[model samples]
Target: MLAEERMAIILEIINEQKAVKLSQLCEMLDASISTVRRDINSLADMGKIVKVHGGAMALDDNFSFIEHNVEEKLALFTEEKIAIAKYAASLIEYGDFVYIDAGTTTEKMIDFIPQKDVSFVTNGFTHAKKLAQRGFKVYIPGGEVKFVTEAIIGAECVMTLKSYNFTKCFIGANGISVSAGFSTPDVREARVKTAAIDGSRKAYVLSDHSKFDKITSATFIPLNRATIITDKLLDKKYTEYTSVKEVL
Candidate 1:
């Protein structure tokens, strides 16, 4: 095939799938890896697509700078959040040291978590309270609480995470992208999330379909670092970068 023909097919595949691996593009175009890489570079330079490690993704125009309060977020995606939360909660086992991040979905998870033997550490003030009320041993970090999300964020929160090695952690994200990975609007909050994920043996990011293709101010985790539990996955290509579980 001519270079133009191959490039056009590449663009079509990425646009359709939202993202694609370099190897897949090469196989589809019947071109060498170098040839596909060059075409991807050209497309990236043209601002038609974003180049990610091992692949390319459709350019995302949705960038979130502001974070809505918990009440506002609670009203959106309620059903989907509950489904994802329930599935996340089921992953917790007896005697597990779980870290639950602050967000509407993670908060819902507290409701479904039935393990009474598990201990919890959280940066979310509300999550900590809810977990305690549910008869679980809950520990909250000391830090400046962000009023909008009611989440503890700062150096103290990050330091607190360092002392405990959790068996599992459920985290929340403002955005998830092939290029930007898992991101949130606040840098301080991102730091706490980073610490939590780093200190845990396993990490899961709970999100809804609306979070996909979105970018935020700071990225706390890479795509491969955690499994994603969502309402639905619109892009099959994301599975190539990370493990994605769709609850609905």
Candidate 2:
């Protein structure tokens, strides 16, 4: 395709979605990665689109930050959380060693997790208790518990995660952005989430569609580092970066 044609299509996509990842552009244009990247650079240089860390955004696109405590978050997306949690739980298999992150959605997963020969490690105090009650072997790292989120954080927890190689991990994010990746409000908690993802063979970010396009204080992992499982995906461009499963 001609450079002019590709650039025009790219601009139209950005305007429609408010942002576009380079990978998405490459796929949509049926062009090579290098070609798409060069096109993005040219567009950025001409002041037609704003280039970000891993993607381009419309000039008027806004990046906002906000955080809510666990209780408040739990009340916001109740049904979506259940559906997302149920599907996530279905992915677990017997003998799988899993790391479960602390969040309202992930908490719901504990109930749906099938009765099997599976083991779990978690930073959420409530998550640990729930798993143990179900007769599953559960481990909790030694760390200072953050009151607002009720999850364990700090270097100690990170160190503990480093020793385990989990088969699968379910994580939570405060925000999911193509440009900024997966983010959380606290740097310490982000460190814990990063460690878990790095130590696991496979990682999944459990979030509702409400988290999309938002950014937070600290980014734990990049957009491509893990698959996202959400209740709904408003923007399909996210699939250009990594795998996304919409349980709805």
lDDT of 1 by residue, 53-104 (tens): 5677777678666799998999999999999999999999988999999999
TM-score of 1: 0.77
For model 2, the superposed segments whose C-alpha errors exceed 4 Å read 1-65
Quality of model 2 by C-alpha lDDT: 0.89
Q: Which is the leading candidate under TM-score? A: 1
Tens-digit lDDT track of model 2 for 1-248: 78998899998898788666778887888898899889888988998876665577776444544567888988998999999999999999999999999989999999999999999999999999999999999999999999889899999999999999999999999888876789787889899999999999999999999889887666789899999999999999999999999999
All candidates' TM-scores?
A: 0.77, 0.76
Q: What is the lDDT of residue 26 in candidate 1?
A: 82
In angstroms, the error of model 2 at 221 is 0.7
State the displacement of the C-alpha of residue 73, model 2, in Å, after optimal TM-score superposition: 0.8
Which candidate number maximizes lDDT? 1
